[model samples]
Target chain A: MQENILTLRDIVVEFDGERILDKINLSIRDNEFVTLLGPSGCGKTTTLRIIAGFVEPNAGEVLFEGQKINGVPPHMRQVNTVFQRYALFPHLDVFENVAFGLRIKKTPKDELNRRVMEMLELVDLKGFEKRSVQSLSGGQQQRVAIARAVVGKPRMLLLDEPLAALDLKLRKEMQLELKNIQQSLGITFVFVTHDQEEALSMSDTVVVMQDGVIQQIGTPEDIYNEPANAFVADFIGDSNILDGIMKRDFLVSFEGQECACLDRDFAPNERVDVVIRPEDVDIVPTQLGIFTGTVESSLFKGVHYEIVVDVSGYKWYIHTTDNVEIGAQVGLKFGPEDLHIMHKMFDGTTNVLQGEVVGEDEIEFLGVRFTRENLGLPVGAPVRLTFSPYDIIVAPEEDRDATVYVESVIYKGRFSELIVWKDETQLILRTQRDEQVATDIGVDFNFDHIKIEPLGEKADA
Target chain B: MKSKVPAYPYFGWMAVFTIIPMLFVLYFAFIGDDGQFTLDGFRRLADPYMIAIFLKSLWLALLTTIICLLIAYPMAYILSRMKLNTQRTMMLLVMLPMWMNFLLRIYAWMMLLENNGLINKLLGFIGLGPFQLIGTTGAILAGMAYNFLPFMVLPIYSVMTKIDGSLIEASQDLGCNFFGVLRRILLPLSFPGVITGITMVFVPAASTFVISQRLGGGELMIGDVIEMYFVGAEPNFNTGASISLVLMLVILIGMGIMNLFDKDEMEGMLI
Candidate 1:
């Protein structure tokens, strides 16, 4: 293993009495490219700032090259940062900006010119030396910012959502270029971003975090394949969770159906949740094998056909290359090896039982409603739903959705929320389901997907 | 009803509004006894009495500006470096002096600087005899400096605070120690403010009479010289006007040089 370039041990940060990072322990190795990926408000930015020494950690020691840096100022630290805005001095030209650090160090004029030229070449910004920073385009400005920081030859580089301000194509291009630069230079990079794909695509090690704590730290494949917690699994990628009880080694029951799942440290009748990725699920020709589902809705995304099927009155989602018409019968096929089992953190029993008939294009529980857009379901039709025993959600109250009030409406990035009353069950689906002023909704749920936790562990008031 | 302004006439209007007053001053400068042009006013410009007064006024203005700058630069720097609320409160406090009547403030300073006034009384409390500070060039310069300190401070302070502090940090990071940063970065960056403040304080200080009248016991200055020509001596309007014109020309030429100093590249050096 390479030497640990920087170590953050038991780090805690608090702002105005509210905890932003709690016991965050991260060790970045020499020449490693690590990306901290999370949703906004997950304290990814705070962790980056702590490493940069811009903000003093309330509790934790940041060790650089095995020396504790608790009281080190940002300027004195051997870590340099590229701010999101590129923070280039608008008044300075490209040469001046890149030479800024060197100039501050009082290097000889000839050496300054030589190094600034070398840095400009390193960032592929030759002939841009005389151009004003403000006159450079966004991508060029970003290149200059990179040049400015790296010119200092700091031990570690901290990038705080540096590419967030770029357009889509430029952002994608910058990602590849940044990765190339990191590899070529062999420098330790600790990058913070809310973009999951960018982190997965660029980082050698991806650290997924939530609520100020590291949920999982592993290679991109490890994070994608085996998430440490449900939050990590959900945040890293879309994982369909089913509530079930472990019947025995490799056997779990979900949606009132017993199926084999990957074995975990457990005994018989132990509650567990089985997580299955979307692409891992397959739709076969309609046949009465393990279970059969009716096509409730179908959506065609240029590359693949996404169909929502109603299996045993529960809505089951499947993505496929083959197109199936709405209201058509379909077969669900998945090997037992693909089903990953995780014990519920809250309660022993993972299996929960409750579901309702969902329509084709739209799904409805009691009061909870959802549009089956990509699921390829039909409108106002009875659809059979088949999922693992853990998928169905049997809750005392609704959290992700609303009932009686249609009470609140909120717009989050790529996701939204709604509150409606299903006679008695106030249900919430914190899913990327859009429900507008009067959007039709339907839901065919199964016990397999709703991994059950005990009602006692609702967040403390 | 607003009338449609024809284009050519507007240029004529501009000349009438702005150019005629200058021509009037120019005309008054050379008018003779029969209302003809003469050189008596120009000769009076060389008079030893008049020349002495002019030199005194010029030196006094220069002294006042330099003194004000010496005090105000640090004051402005301290104020701009303070927290926003404190900065604003301090600015208000500095401007408070300007809000009072100028003559009244001068009178108050007179009370402070006079032979048996506040300074002497305070000295008496220290077992020293009463001292005299009023009716002197130093007294006039003090009065001028105190009155103009605000004008000098505020512009410099405005420019100083507008400087992006990150530049300083960048300078330090690049190996510029604090003092080096001040000389290479802070000084050049703040030159425009100096120009503005100097222009603001010096112009009024160069011509004001009341400051010298009360503080210098109605002695001599360019104002005294011009007033002597108009109301004190033989009432020579041509010479008086010519003397005023000469002082005016001197001011204009100094401002022209200032404009040259404040050319394009240095214009951007504000802050």
Candidate 2:
């Protein structure tokens, strides 16, 4: 087994009272290509910055080769980063830019020239060393950035969306080139990008993040085949996620049909999320299928036909090479191994608070009045309000209605679950932003997300 | 092309306001007072007193440019790093004095530098002398630097702000400490702005007569001599024109030398 080259423990970063990274724990192995994959503002770049020593985590230890390097500056660390925009020195030629690190280390003249020439050759720009970086094309500039970063021969290289600025064909070429370079150099690479395809194709391990929290970390194959949650299943590729109940071990029920699955260890009759990849579903004769549905739309997606089927008012997307007519009765067939069962991210049983209807479309909870629609209950009527923990928005103190004191914060894979209290009432909420324990903050509800049920109706159910 | 039509009026304006005036200066420079061609106007420049005055002007202007640059580079760097709103407010404060009349601003500086003015009064509180600050070379130099500081700052600040911040981070990532980044990246990249700032400050300081007249109390710089020959009791437009032509050539040559340091960047800016 390869030794761990870098380890980030409980890393937390906050900017302007907003948490940008929350308790991120990641370990990168030596000579491994790890990609931090997420959309914009997902803190993937921030994680790369922390590893490159450009950002100081608020609360965490950065262990490089098992030695704590939290306060070490970027220049002192044996890590280099290729900036998102390439950040090639505009004043320097290609040769000088690649020689920057070596010159800074005061390498001897002969070796410096040899190393710079080798790096330029590795980047496939042997004769173009004397060319000004400004005059080069975007793809060429990206190559220079990579060469300049790796020429220092740092233990680890951090690339921040370096290929994002390139054209599609060029980006694809660079992806393979980068993977090749990593293998040849045997240097650990921590790359950050929002391109899912790039991450899947290039990285040995993919760390999927959403809103500053690492949703899942696994090998690319594991991340795609056995996603940890609905978010990962949806983010990794096209999939149909539906609510299902785990009837028993290796068996789940969805759409009023029971189907055998590969998942186990769930309580009987427990609610779960079922994920089926669009490409995994097989179209077959109606009598041979586990379930039948009417094809609503069929699109020619080059290599395959993308068919959307209406399975009891729920759309099931399926991709197949076989063409099926629109509005045709089709049978959906998928193996038990294709059905990925995951524990539901949110359970409706929790985050239910009792409130009184104060006005039309208004309900009062925890001494704060919020405007909610379709209350239907008269004034002074009691109601039970249920909302997803993700809907609880934490606001700054000056912008809040009811002040809540944070009691505890648990770092879920996707968000921070907080147990906060106001007066005598305690509430559980989930947010991407990290809040300090024992601190007072303002709380607000996304009114659109609140589900109101009359008190008497809840008793009957 | 129709696109070229819009530039025609500018060409006309250049001819009337710039080209023709330059021609007139050249014409007058070669003409004698008797309306005949003579080398006497150029010969008069060889006098020791005139040469001394010209050299003094050059030296003072060089000192002023160096002083302004020393003060402005760091100031621009700090300003560039400030928050956008704070940077705007600070820039406004830097430019606030320029909104007033130019002569009025110089007069204000004179008041401050006078022996009994606010500066000396403040110095008196610390038991320092009511020093003779006005009517000295120091006063003239101070006035020139003060008046031209914004010119030195504006270009450098604009350039520094336009510098992609990631370059600094990239440099640091490549094992560059703060000073290394500055020396290798910031200084070389901002060279064009420095050259521009030098041009803007030096040209004005070399030819400025008002600051010396107000602060130096009758000291004769080359600008004062040119002013005397043009509009004094003994007005000599020929000599004045010749001096003006010489000054323009000297400035052009100085700029040409500055361009050698950053030929590509200068061309980039021009294009």
Best by TM-score: 2
| lDDT score for candidate 2 against the true structure | 0.88
Q: Identify the CAPRI category of the predicted complex in candidate 1.
A: incorrect
**Residue-by-residue lDDT tens digits, candidate 2, A133-237:** 888999999999999999989999999999989999999999999999999999999999888889999999999997678999999999999999876887787
Per-residue lDDT tens digits of candidate 1, residues A34-148?
A: 9999877778988987877667899988899999989776667777788777777655578988987887677899988888899899788999998877778899989998988
**Per-chain TM-score of candidate 1, chain B:** 0.87
Model 1 quality (TM-score): 0.72
- After superposing candidate 1 on the true structure, give the runs of residues whose Cα lies further than 4 Å from its correct spot: A15-18, A241-259, A263-275, A286-319, A326-461, B1-17, B32-34, B47-100, B108-194, B212-244, B255-271
Question: Superposing all C-alpha atoms, what RMSD in Å does each candidate have to the true structure?
Answer: 11.4, 6.5
Please report the candidate that would top DockQ against the real structure.
Answer: 2
- Could you give candidate 1's per-residue lDDT for residues B148-201 as a string of tens digits? 999999899998897776566545443455576677567766778988999999
Per-prediction TM-score to the true structure, in the order listed: 0.72, 0.85
